[model samples]
Target: MTRITDTRDGPAEGARPGALPVAGLLLAAGGGRRLGGRPKALLGHLGRPLVEFAAGVLRDGGCVPRYVVLGARAADVRNRAELPGCVLVDNPGWADGMGSSLRAGLAALAATDAPAVLVTLVDQPRVGAAAVARLLAAHRAGAGLAAAAYGGERGHPVLFAREHWEGVALSAVGDRGARAYLRAHAGAVALVECGDVAAPDDVDTPEDLRLLD
Candidate 1:
């Protein structure tokens, strides 16, 4: 899971008010042990790297200045991933788990004037710009936490409210990311039904990629 929140009121000066302060946090730190140590983001999908597709979705959704958190094989992924305006962040503690990457991404977002963030994974090719926009709109419409749900299962690219930024930051430190944190604050979360079967599909192994093909 990835933790992204709104921080439009951050210390950063010159941030636009009511502009839906949002950032795109792309988590590219997975080791991909399931794929025999391959960098999943670098994997090809229809002639484009997985990371590119994910970034394109965020970009199309109007997510400004996306930030990608890298871990193992960071250099290779960075060089191969073709995200024109994305900012890369190296997460040295990514070995700990997805939580570490989330924290690192959040730390970088905190510096920006963005009040909300849309966090997604590089391996989830099924999640598109429409899904991201839906979640963002829901969050801005007063939901503290807005996430896409497929077949009743809550999935990635969750949009978090700025009020919960600190909790998300603290939760994303160990092996777990924001699962427990979101669960504990269930009252603040609103689930948006994606209905699309592709929304929950993620490429974690060669077979998963083949399925997409």
Candidate 2:
């Protein structure tokens, strides 16, 4: 069973009054087979695990209830990282790929009744808090579908309203992960430009790791 630690919200303490509060859903379960089974969540960035940087982005961007989906090597991650205020969700089907983690993260939000969720990938350290804030601001401004656009190209850290959860979950198959769903609703998505503030370079191959300082 997926354990949702820190499930209590009560509007999540730090949310400003009248602000459109949303949960931050982090897909951090990748086993990184491409990186020889190294878990992406545990990858060191800035002397801290990548997950820590991601959570900071969400919090700084005003995401109320933060949820992190951990899969491959989940136990080791829990032991090595300090995700103090995040809801740690275990994705049993994580071996299947991003789709499983995506489903698990969203399902964990069932009881929170969050108006929306902002989803981000753990491997994109360069896609920092600033990009997240841009997408979050769009959500606050009532944009149902939003994402950080780099040079007008759609990318990660997408925001989906409450009503679109089911659709996203249904289409989140294999490693596609909301890609098909977002493509289906392109017109509805509000592209927030963040190229100036951040980049969405994912740390996948060893060479990509060089992007991190």
The lDDT of each candidate is: 0.77, 0.88
Question: Candidate 2 residues 74-142, lDDT tens each?
Answer: 889888888867889999899998998999998989778689999999999888888888888898787
Query: Lowest-scoring 10 consecutive residues by lDDT in candidate 1?
Result: 6-15
Candidate 2 runs further than 4 Å off: 7-11, 17-20
- Report RMSD for candidate 1: 5.0
Q: Candidate 1, which segments miss by more than 4 Å at Cα?
A: 1-20
Best lDDT among the predictions, by candidate number: 2
**Candidate 1 vs. true structure, TM-score:** 0.87
- lDDT score, candidate 2, position 198: 89
